[model samples]
Target: MRLRALLTTAALLAASACGATPDAPAKTTLTWWDHYDSGAADQAVTALIARYQGAHPDVEVKRTAIPPAEFRAKLDQAAASGAFPDVVAVDSPDLPRLVAQNAVADLTDRFQGWAVGEALLEPVRESARHGGRFYGVPLRSETLALVYDREVLAGAAPPRTWDDLRATAKALTRDGRAGLCFAGLPEEDLTSTFLAFLWQAGGDLDTVDDEAGVEALAFVDELVNVDRSVPAAALGWDNAQVAREFAAGRCAMMVNGPRVVQVLNQAGMNWSVTALPSGAGGSASPLGGETWVIGKGSRHADAAWELLKSLAENRDNITEFGAGLGALPNRGDTVQDLAWQWDPNVAAFAAQMPEARPRNGYGTKYPQVSEAVWTMVQQVLKGDREPEEAAAEARAKIEPLLRER
Candidate 1:
């Protein structure tokens, strides 16, 4: 309640200062669109906007928060209509396509002197860049990890290797808990998990015939069909559902991000997180984050850039935003801050951040490719196809998409 009151006060002050200043140049109104769907995350973003507005009274940012499911479709429609917002918080994976289609502006020049832009962790920066140019600024980042009930795994260590993971999960599968579970429902969520698995097996999207692809799928198949360790309900669950189940004690262990840590802390559940189990490729994870971009049709690009530059220069904004959302810091410098260095879970995740990999290939057709990957997982999970056959079919489906420029 106190925090909400503070935010409201901040917003009112920003709004009050937004009027024209006789001594300054004409005020510019910048339209900003964001898809921070969760309540706390959404609050953080709106507060950030208010802070920006308070500092730069000459620039009034009209912000809109969209539902995540509708964001892409709405943005695409707006882009086609030449009415895209001036500033946008875009999904990291979608930036490549937006840049390719000229829906977003290239930020290379604006990012040059910006310390935050320059100090962004490599994987976070890579998510916003393509073909030697930066198209967006890193917002926040997240990755899948082992979130476990500390009480449940009192004696057993969090899984370290594939063998350990499988054995531990099977051993823990009792007492009304599924042992191990994760989201594998559809589209991005399922595909993101698959990317982590694929990379762990030492395979990447470019190679269709890589044996590792089948190996990874086979492992997941064993967990579901053979070992019966993960509940069949997980096959239809999404990330939120997976987190809730873990928090509710429906599962002893879950593969999810740190965003749920705050809820776990509130619920007073004895929980801890560790790096995802290492495989043949060692520790590797799929990356996810939001990127701030200037839309192609933005008339107030200068004002938009100013807003972005302010956000980059303000490290506190980044840190506070990440803390509010339970997301990882997107910049290397921020990771070194004393606020994060002492937190055990954040420190553990920081150790793995360097090894994180972008889930989407650096291309415009990633959505199609990801759909293919998830489809294969669904087919294999249903026992409708062998891992080898499913992987081959998946690769075949995505080959054409990858070949697109």
Candidate 2:
């Protein structure tokens, strides 16, 4: 079946709940589900919803936050049951899966004249587009950076070059603290961290069988094995654990983004942020963030589009949303102000924005392909597979998926 048809079927399965009632109010209530559970995220989303509601008093928005761990499963269950939300917030990488399953709306009609069209970052917009149709609205975005505790670094600053990073991490890996804390688990986060290195090494994950690929994989293994800068627990650590370890000062530095900065700040930890260490080619980081998508089955398509437009098109709304969530605005103009530049933490992350890369070619199967790469890395980290073997294994697993896309 075509993607749209698949989505229609999923939508029907999920919508069986409301049971037809002619007496229902003429104004539709759109349900929006997201994985943002923090106070800041909630407040940001709430403000956006309120703004949207004000513009169209007839439309009611029911927003709910699902735990990230269970989000995918719940979404799947909703799809199977034909009772999905009217709109959903999805990470760029996972958007493709929904698109493939035909669970999202074709947003091409909604893009024209939307102020968000002018403001959205290109890479973010591209991620939400598939087969010539746009599926989502770019919301808040984030990119990876090196986060370190000022007290641990003392007078010395965080490293700039890849070599400098390695040496600094080695030097800082004393006592119970690790020099680097990265997610090495069997998940997409681990793949994201690895991809930063691969790109830095002038390699591409799509071409994982090359020399740069081997070197990229080896470089991480070196940190885990020879350099001993990473903790053994990293093998089991997911993205959240890496951030937690850094916030607790168990790691001197970590590969993370602004969200981690917000977490550390909330915990009363003293820390600073810097661009990710540069490789031979210089600094690089992956673009990460959420996108707003209308469900393929949404009965109130035009109303959903209006909500999406209000959320992403209004500059003031975007600013308020980004500010509350500690997220950088998707538009360059909004983030180029002197205020953001002067803030050391925000400055470091902003510095890497110029070199930030979207997930390469397999935009849709990003999550699945990423997991395959992580599986390969995990084997190498555990000494169960050599770097070359791991790269080969990753390529073997990813090739078929890429073909499907």
Candidate 3:
């Protein structure tokens, strides 16, 4: 019996030494999840993953594309199950919540020495960092801009300054068409648009009681009150409504992102885009878009990091991804690259990236804070409260949310 056991042990040791333990099950397949289900974006990511797999034949990548609306819920369930993807793509605004939950991995060391690190725009970079540690890598970015009907504007130039925009919007309000449209519903879209105006007015959500905050609220109030260019229904509009209204030519101009331009063009509307109007302080727009992150529970973290680094730093990949998907590139150098700069519409959006501001005090509880502000805005627009009263009420609500964060 001892002789037989010794022989069996020797056989097992030899099998391990010879790398014959079923070849380690051919290396665990890496899973990548993204909230990009649109046609071009899906194709581009498929192609990029194919290229990555081709380069690393030893590693297999499994891709799952989720629609933006269902992404958070799906991710939450996956995380709870310990089956979260090795790599995740999340919007900048949503990243804070993920970070707060300790769901994402710290990527400071992973991104070190990467070309994408140097190429990232400051605003986009700041959005990916939490507590001085980089938590995500910006893959694409965008900012709100004025999308105007070229035929409607006619000889009139797009507004370059805030004062100019107010005047232009007022002028364009004739003929049963609104001068401007915005998403002002109780949602992140409305909060984002409002923040742009606030930032342009030199205000921030964190400092809602300051002069800039008051001015921003007053400015929005003017659009409804003194100017009367924006329709009262705008208070209930979301992103889709704003786009639909603009596409139908019900609004001569609207504050929207790059996707709006794409939608308008697809619908055969004659439109042009310009930078968000500069306010008393300067030009500013709220930064929007997703970042690539590694989940804390990932088993193939090293492989995922490599994939993220490749996707973010490779100029060809960046250009291909952004161009195919109509996403704005996050890299400043990529924005200036001849390939990206050649597209006039893209160039216009890129110009605004420098002034793009991420949400103030971006952390957990952002949604709660956003909801409170939106409610206040809605009340003010509905004539239930004055701007000062609304601002104070919003401040009161947001202060508690911030403390919870």
Candidate 4:
């Protein structure tokens, strides 16, 4: 309650800064916010906004790019104060919390009229909806893939099944180099990467304590504790660090998202990517990306939606931004553009899009569930707890969280 009071006060001050007076301009100005703070992604956003303003002279968009680390906390504060910007780019996993709070506008009817709305990939489309209604527009997407060093693998074909992966990793583990590396810390990446393995073992978060889940966790145990193929230090590495380890030749392969392509290219390493190996349940990967949403409090909801359409509907514009963002285009029509299809660095990740599973089904309380899942992963990997015991305890903590939402 006290935090809410402070946020309300802050909102009032911010509102005063934008208040209209006799001398103020009559043109409509939509305030926009996003977390694309650097590199091509930021450049892409700035250019897109400028293009929109150029075409719509009467409407102006004011953009604010927040640092990725602080973006969510700042958004929560804005929601609490009912002072959200007119338009915002939100991470896919974080959308449910805002929807549950009634902080975003319903876009189902608006989406129905959109010419290319049906062209979005199913997982990407599903990630932007809540309660079977649209609340956001997916802008970009990506999923995990296995990247291996060609020379390190010694001309061997990439692993295809669980036994193949284990033997391949063990063989590649020698000369002070680990065979495989993946993000294992207690963060969003950890949960997203682990979900792929869990699903491959025929276990969803809802059945996380089942036999399939135990089998998945036990495989991870064998890799880290028994075979010693994956290093114990993985418990502290995030996605970037894992990429760094791979680039430095300390590891031979890694399970990571598309962004690591840039890091590998800069390092000038010989690499290729493939879909993650299958388990008992078959192949699966997690969907991840950003969505464009309108604030429920926006006075210019119509104009905000129009801007989002302009960003998404045009074939050229969608392709341009998708390339700059280093991810797959959301639209099925544009996803197979010549460059994306031919580029080895991204082709495998692109192929996984149709089957990628979104986390939206976990409900609004997913963040809490994510924490529990990653903690269980860390404990098991560290040999601090047995796989069955850790998974059972984590399942106990997550069941009520999903029910509460």
Best by lDDT: 4
Candidate 2 has its poorest 10 consecutive residues by lDDT at: 335-344
Instruction: Give the lDDT of residue 307 in candidate 2.
Output: 83
TM-score of each: 0.91, 0.86, 0.87, 0.90
Candidate ranking under lDDT, highest first, comes to: 4, 1, 3, 2
Q: Candidate 2 residues 51-147, lDDT tens each? A: 8888888999999999888998887787777777899988777777777777888888778766657566676667677776788887767888888
Q: Any runs in candidate 3 off by more than 4 Å, and if so which?
A: 1-27, 80-82
Full ranking by TM-score:
1, 4, 3, 2
lDDT by residue for model 4 over 81-187, one digit each (tens)? 99999999998878889998889999999988576788888898899998899999887788898999999998999998888889999999997799998898889
The true-versus-predicted C-alpha distance at residue 19 of model 1, in Å, is: 16
Total colliding residue pairs, candidate 4: 0
Candidates 1 and 4 compared by lDDT, better number: 4
Query: What clash count does candidate 2 reach?
Result: 8
- Candidate 1 lDDT, 142-231, residue by residue in tens: 778888898999967789988988998998899678889988797788888877878888887766447888888998999988888899
Error of 3 at 190 (Å): 0.5
Candidate 1 regions with alpha-carbon error over 4 angstroms: 1-25, 341-344
Each model's C-alpha lDDT? 0.81, 0.80, 0.81, 0.87
lDDT of residue 160 for candidate 2? 87
RMSD of each: 9.2, 10.7, 5.0, 10.2
